[model samples]
Target: MDTVLKINNLYVGLKDMTIVKDFSLDIHKREIIGIVGESGCGKSTMLKSIVGLSDNNVSIQKGKIDFHGVSLRSMDQNQLRSIRGNKISFIFQKPDYTFDPVMKVKSQFFETVKFHTDGKANKKDCYKRSRELLEQLHFEAPDEVLESYPFELSGGMNQRIAVAMSMINEPELILADEPTSALDVSVQSQVVRTLMELRDKTGVAILMVSHNINVIASMADMVGVMYGGRMVEYGDAREVLQKSRHPYTKALLDAVPAMSQTMPESIEGAPPRFSEILQGCPFRERCPFSENKCETEPAIQGDASHWWLCHKQ
Candidate 1:
């Protein structure tokens, strides 16, 4: 598969505190790479940094993000904007924040279509495509949805619309920051299915950040486990999820409730805050397998396709 996105040694910080440190990953064409981690571990920040959406206080101290051969880090505001919604799109966690409550869905969607196409596409063609995408995602009434205001629709409806909107340009890559976080279980399942179908049909690569382990297990071809703003484990999804080498990755998988198990075992102790400076392994405080070597940062272990940053591994 072709490499669609490449992130190398990225370091992102807000003012005095660094959140993402020495993180690197690659996403291939038509592939889904799921990043699963606890809140404030820089999962969302990673996505924002990729699209140049980080706040004024946030800074990319060091890194190179290449989208197909283009250097994202060197791009100016205009350059970033042109590529953001056209070549790369984002699906935010909050569906409610994505739309203008006062505007009808039709007007908002039309504006998006025009923005991506540089006003070359007519409303007739845009509407036709919109309805088709909505129908493909299992929407019963695309016409009704297009006519309704965002405030009038349910959360699930708006989320599906948000997903549909991100697909408007048929972007080469989609950065999803907990896209199903705001929905209920059933709705989350539907949205995941929709995303899977979209990938199958359009061959768009995805970099998704989610706290839900099961969601990652269901959709990701590659998986990266993050802790304290660092990638602790990364590999092919099957190996990372089933034959996990990192203690943090195993803990996350163990936390997921199973029908066969009496109860899920939650990891003890909270993830260290990014603001705190740690000398050794970030997971050392909570790692059950921690040893003397864990007091010092361990070297990464494993092959090119599967690796873990841990002493035990």
Candidate 2:
């Protein structure tokens, strides 16, 4: 499989505080890499840095962000703009905020296609493409959706539209930041199924960041568990989810609600604060099996296919 996006030893920060530390991952063509972590774990920050959309206060301090063997971090604004919504697209958490309240759905789609094509694409052709994508996304009445305003549709409809728009350009990779987190249970399932089907049909790679482990378990080809702005464990989705080694990863999976009567186990202590530089394992404070060696930085353990940073293993 061809690698779509690569991040090596990435470090992102807000002024003096490093929020994303030594983060790295390779997303292959048509692969889904799901990153699961609690809030403030730098999942969104990492996604923003990949697209060069990090806030004014946040910046990539060091590391490489390569797309198709090309350096994305080295690209200037003009260069990045050409790839932003064309070769690479972003699906934000809030679909309502992504579109203009006043603009009709079809018009918004046209603007996206036109902006990426430098206003060379015909409106009629763009409409045809949009309708096709909406249909694939399971929109029964694609034409009605195109004619309606964003506010007129439900959150689920808007999110599906967001997914459709992201695929309209046929991007190589889609950086989805909590795409289904904002929707209810039923809608979440719909959006997840649509995205999975979209991947099957288009072969577009995806880097999805979410707090929901169950969602990740159902769709991701690879799973990455992050804490304190660092990847604590990563491996095949089944291996990481079922036979996870890292304490943090285990805690996360245990916390997920199941059908059994027993309550889910919760991890003690909160996630580490980035303002202060953390030494040793970030989860050492909360890990039940912590040893004296855990006071210092833990060495990388496990095989190439499945690995983690911990002293226990």
Model 2 worst lDDT run, 10 consecutive residues: 258-267
Residue pairs of candidate 2 with colliding backbone atoms: none
Candidate 2: C-alpha lDDT = 0.92
Per-residue lDDT for 106-155 in model 2, tens only? Answer: 99999999988888989999999999999888799999999999999999
- Candidate 1 regions with alpha-carbon error over 4 angstroms: 259-262
Best by TM-score: 2
Highest lDDT model number: 2
Q: Write the per-residue lDDT of candidate 1 for residues 39-82, one digit (tens) a residue.
A: 88898898899988997789888999999888999999888988
Q: List the global CA lDDT of all models.
A: 0.89, 0.92
Q: For residue 275, what is the lDDT in candidate 1? A: 76
- Which 10-residue window of candidate 1 scores lowest in summed lDDT? 257-266
TM-score of each: 0.96, 0.98
- Model 2 alpha-carbon drift over 4 Å, by segment: 259-261
